[model samples]
Target: MLRVKNPVLPGFHADPSILRVGNEYYIANSTFEWYPGVEIHRSRDMVTWEKVASPLSEKRLLDMDGALASCGIWAPCLSWSDGLFYLIYTNVRSWNAGAWKDTPNYLTTASSIEGPWSDPVYLNSSGFDPSLFHDDDGRKWLVNMEWDWRKTGSHQFSGILLQEYSTEQKALVGPIQKIYPGSEIGMVEGPHLYKKNGWYYIFAAEGGTSYEHAMSVGRSRCLTGPYEFHPHNPLLSSYGHPEIRLQKSGHASWCDTPDGRSYLAFLCGRPLPGTLDCVLGRETSIVELEWRDDWPYLKPAPGEELFPSGAVRNWPADSFEPPVVLDEYRKKGEFPPATKSIEYRFDGSAIHPDFKNLRTERDPEVYSLTSRPGFLSLRGGQSPVSHWGQSLLARRQTDFSFSAETKLEFAPTSFQHLAGLCWRYDETNQYLCALTFDENLGRVLKVLTFVDRQFMHYDPVPVPGDGPVWLGLTVQVDSGRFRYSPDGKTWRILRPVLSAAVLSDEFGGMGFTGAFTGMFCIDTLDYTARAYFESFKYTVL
Candidate 1:
């Protein structure tokens, strides 16, 4: 029997759009502000998953030059019809600027998941989370939220809209119609259309994308009409019920197995108990379901109990398994340093795609492993402020308490040259501990923390070293400490123990992403400054 985990795909993999073509299952996730957007994962047994290829690999499709931390690609909808695969996503310029301002959605297609995807076809600037619905009769439709934030009313989110799409023309046609106004729950988005049992079903995310997040559905006999709301309304949610391990559970898509069994994949998070800090960010989880009287009900895992006393439910163990991680509960002493190596694991490691492949958002050809064997060479490009040229590589922080250290070799000549380890929650909220040349303090090491894009504290210490400096960070739940070691045996404190809770979704106003601790380099003045990283060691304590 295969034991499938709850968070089948973990860490920064959110707003999943799962599709099944034959026996192969393909899942696409939202890569907000990250390059190589729309990360796709493939699986056979529905338990073990592998990253196949990223669809948005070209810079022409996504230009995130100055995009904010959580404002790049929002919800990406992937589907297969006929012989080609279709993908639709939004380029969120800035969430802080305005809700509906300059947010353009686009569509792209490819014959195979791995190869040259067609150039992005502009869909509309109406709103984000766009999806393509191909009817069984060969007709196609596009559905998404109509953002009316400028309107002077409580209902800024203008209901879901639908439009006819011509696959041959590769464009949308006819008048847009407001199909379903949305459920009673506000902040509704992430809509996916499904037809089953001779009824058109609409599934959407509601109550924002936070702890109050939920999934609601409505059905109708026609494609666009006065859809009848399900009496149960939110078919599944963890909102208000704090006891549930899976919080912020919504934005779901349904899929059927080869044998005709039903399953749902959705975005969810597991935060620290009392602090409610989700360092792992929103992840993907699957749950089984059963239909009764034309309505769907979530079938919980074995021994699963809901708050306030709900019916005892269970699913076939071989087909479905609850979210389980190997090291989420291990103590500090349990992880022996000898056994813990930086060899990348898709579920836990910060390295996206794979280890040894360090990448910036949209900047390709910036880092090289062949130039210096066994070491990563990152050239200076733009500072972290710029979304495009920022020469940075980061992996999601999956544990509340963990220790990460890296050795950097760099010789800085000007103040513009900087290289170090960074704990980032976005461009604005981050912490940098690096080695740089200070005119007065020659070879100096410093630690700086930024909150809301402003420097909160800066501490510099004189370190007598020409090269090969070790920078480390130790984060224990709410607090974090920085250290610098001249030799592997001896270390010195670089900064005062500070509050890492600020990186939480609740504290970091720009909080769609969790903290990413990794090495980075910035040549704000020119693209000449270079830094080589020898090794990286990360351990979940």
Candidate 2:
């Protein structure tokens, strides 16, 4: 037997849709406001996974220009049938507007996972979290959660709708039906349909995506009729169990092994030691399931307790308790080892697959690897807060304690030309240690921070010459500080320690993504200034 750690895919991977083709398993995750809409990882043994593709790579398939923070792609569903892979996703134009949400869902297909995928076909904007179900009768159907913005709170998630999709016409046809209205646990979404043992089952996410989140199931003998809820409604949840290492556990997808074992892939968050802040974001985890009396339930690992009381109990609607911090919970070795270290030399022809840009695809006008051989050349564009063309490349900050170092060769004649390293959560919340120009000093290094829309600038240190300079940032749990080095060996502290807690989902309030650390260049003056980054290195502390 193989013992697998939780969160096989870490750092911002959420809303997993798992599918198996032949002997290979694939999991596609949502990428909110980041470009390359969906993240797909593949695994052969279910214990180790590697990123294989990001399907929505072109702007034609996904256009998210000016998309606000946490408002882009929601839950993406990936399925396979007839030697073709189907991908369905939502492009949320606006979600924060009062009593209204513009969520337009679309569908795209590819013969292979790593594709030249076809342009997306527009589906319905009536709701989000769309799924494709290929029935055994050689017919296809689409199911999605209907959003009623007129209603408030949990009522906004009205119900799940089902309709037949014509493969030949490439569009939805026939009458739509409300298959399942959802259980008493409201805020239903992320619907997935499956067939097992002469029964059609529908699984959905309920109780919002916060601490009270859970996965509920219902089954029906017929395809379109009233469904019966499970005897134990919520199939899986960590609602009141604050002692568990994984929190906000729900939004699941299912698959089976060739050996006849069933497994579930769900999204979970690991909050900071003493806070409800998940700085690393929601991730994907897998667990085995056992069937009893035609109903499925989680199978606890050896010597592990499935529930706090050793038996499942019905939790009240308002049973959400304040999250408790038990640092010892993670000491049981449930989490995967932290990423030790990585370095990028920019010697290759393309950027590493681990890096991602905000809201837009990688534009050649902003970044290039061939422009300055052996170095990444970034032609500065707008400021960091702009949703338009911003020359920033970053990777997820996976560990609580880590250090990032980068060497930048930039000659800035004005304060508008800035280049350096950044620890960013979104446009509105971030910390930057940049090298720019000063009126009194020719060239200087400074640290700037923005938290909850408030900005602050630290004192600047003058540099003697205009050559390259190394910038460094070290984050220790709740706080972070910046440093600089003229020579690669000697380092000097550049500023006072600032609060790193602000770079989290809890502090940002309206954000759903995690923090990232990388290099950036901003030229608000002319958008023509260029910054060359020699190298970048990150190490987990």
Candidate 3:
């Protein structure tokens, strides 16, 4: 069952920040490492939205020379103050490095919703997820997730802090003081403070924005004093509810529906059975807000909402049917033509280029194939980031267990003309079960499962010798096993190692990652003599 409005927006959209100017509205989400930072979407009603401009489209604003997929952009908050709109976020060099180890927080502004935004003003590094909270007294507070890096057996850099903003200097005015740390409230990031019922309420994320995610709240009589975690905390979350389709629903920011009615807009990483992974990052979602006895609560009101069912049109009939499932190549009469083209979009990153989203830069001569022209092919990535340099025409891995099948023609050669399906999460994670060509050995199917920073090869299975060979994969995750096949029907099982990190919530964030997104995938060949997709298919088992 899918929500009609499920996925709201696709392709790595995350870290939603909304601002109401007049009758119209604007929302900004983090666009990490991608050349254009902070994508802005405009909407009149709470529903429909269209892309505007990246706040850092100007060269003076920010630079992302070596930004990784989930790094460059941090939590972004959008607010309109004094006829000016502001986008507040942190710019990190790379997630592989660690947050704030390099670039710090910054702010950019524009006059109109669509803008040539102003250059950035550096903010402080004691926090991330920089948000603008304009008080009634005309003072604007810049609150964010406080960052700490004390290594006491656990990983470094895990704590929350808060501070005040200096609009004149475009920086933090006073020394940042710790608001209640996330440990105190069972959450750690995306902190926002609002006033209701004479008490200051704090909304934060817990479980590090992944599968075990939740929206927690606490209140304080003072803005920067002792805060109390709600008795019924995780106000708007499915923390322990396995049935909820919304995974890692945190880093929340709240907006109102005019007339003073409040609502919350946050990003959610929708998990599919296969073909799509959470690494595509997060999608934006909306929920109503209400106050009980003066304290604010996230939508569905404490034990009252359905998982993945928060839409006006959530009936299965109203939603788009899921894509056709495919597991093998060469499926005789039951299959599509040998080749078809697909259309896709990219955030201008080296992984997924701006023009073609289907395929990305895999090697010097090829990129990952997307749906372009009539068929997708490899075009070498001019720009490279991490190990994603391999041309991969991939879609997100939605289901844990499913089959990915494709057709490729390989010429017997020494240099590997790589073609096949892959499961990827970031530069260091994932695996490839592929068809590699060798002059002597001919075309053969293989399985390579990567985990714990190690790529282990399973037994190589030979396929029938042909100019073009069929390749298929059965990556069954529910049982924690991955297999491969030559034809689309039969399969071979490979042993599994625990790859919890790829399936966890901490890795998801903006621009397909900020808070949630799909994993890196490719459908292109590297160092190819020539290869063709008779057809490509992914099926959820």
Candidate 4:
């Protein structure tokens, strides 16, 4: 047996929809408020995974212009049938509108996983987390959790709805039905259907997406019927077990290996020590499943008690061992030295796949790789706090301890034009070490930190000559600081250590995404101000 570590896909990879096609496995996750929506990863042996593609890469496929933080993409479901890959996702237009949630579902299909996915076909706005189920009889159905604003508390989640999808018509037809009203645990969502041995099984996430989150299942003899809840209910959950490293465990998708072994890919969160803040956001973890008496249960390791008395089995962080292992799988190896570091030279025709723009589409007016040939040219648009157009390009902060460095060249005539490296969680919470022109000092570097929407500015440090300056940020767990270098080697601390804890879900009120580190250019005076970034480097410490 090979011990596979938990959180196989770390750093903000949430709402995983796992599927196995032949020998390859693919997991699609939600990219909320980030452009190029869904993030998909590919795996061969279930233990090793790598980012393969982001299907929603064009403006025609996704348009989230003024979407608030964590309000663009939600629970994406990926499936395969009839030689085509089917992807169902929800475009959340409004989530903060008190009692109303304007969630519109859409579907897109492609013959290949890494593909030119077709334009999205509007599905419905009654709910979200929609999934397409291809029945063995050649009929396709869609299942999603219904949302009712009139209802209060958990009742707002309503029930799971089932409807027939006409592939030939490219639309949904026939009458819709409410299959399951959900269990006693409310806030039901992320529905997925599977059939085995004349039994129709429906899996869903319940108890909300917080600490009480869980994975529940129900089964019935018919496709849509009075489903019976699981004998123990919530087949997998980490609730009431704060000792466990993986918290907020729910929103799962299942798949079976070629050897008939069953596994689940679920979203989980890792909170900082002594706090409920998950700076890395919700990640993806895998757990094996066992079927007995036609019901599924989390399979525990030999002599290990799995969810004993509604409590999950605790594993020490130092041990780095999980409670379950995959039999006949190869031993897990350490990540390569090169895998810990990434250096983008900005010489390619397009930005690296690891980098993603905030909210808006990849407009050439805001950013261009060809404008400066060897450098990434960013034309500053709005201020960082604006929800609309902001020239910000960043990547996920995958490690608790890592460093990011970038070289920026910009001639700012006034303080309104700025460009630098940033550690951003959202518009309201971020630390920007920017370069701008001061009245007394020529071009200077200043560190601006925002905590819970409150702003704090540090003293400015003047630059020596008229040349490109190097800016860097290093984070070690809960604390981080900014630095600068003139020759790309010798560096000086630009600001005092600040709390990185603010860049988290708990600290950033109403936030669901994780922290990111990248380069940003802001010009409040005019949208035409340009800044050039020669290179950007990120390394895991």
Q: Name the best candidate (by TM-score).
A: 4
Candidate 4 vs. true structure, TM-score: 0.95
Give the clashing pairs for model 1. 6-322, 6-323, 35-361, 350-395
Model 3, 1-541: lDDT tens digits are: 2112444454356777766777666778776645456778776655456666665654567665545555667778888877788878787754444423554888778787678678778877765776777776778887776554544444333545666777766667776677766644353777777776668778877665565556677888888868887766666554554455665566677766557767667667655444234644576666656666765554443334423454221111112211222333114323332122332333223332222122121232453234233334553332112433434455544444555556554443432444555555544455665565545566665565554345566655665656555455454442244455556456666555434346433433322442111122232333334344545555556
**Pairs in steric clash, model 4:** none
Instruction: In angstroms, give how far residue 166 of model 2 lies from its true place.
Output: 1.2
Which has the greatest lDDT? 4
TM-score of each: 0.89, 0.94, 0.64, 0.95
Ranking of all candidate structures by their TM-score, best first:
4, 2, 1, 3
> Which segments of model 3 are wrong by more than 4 Å?
1-14, 23-27, 30-44, 47-70, 93-103, 112-115, 154-168, 195-200, 210-212, 219-231, 267-284, 298-378, 381-422, 432-437, 441-449, 456-541
Worst 10 residues of 1 by lDDT: 332-341
Candidate 2 lDDT at 212 equals 88
lDDT of 2: 0.85
Each model's lDDT comes to: 0.75, 0.85, 0.55, 0.86
Score residue 301 of candidate 4 by CA lDDT. Answer: 64
lDDT of 2 by residue, 212-244 (tens): 889999999988868899888799888988877
Candidate 1 segments exceeding 4 Å error: 1-3, 153-155, 303-341, 344-365
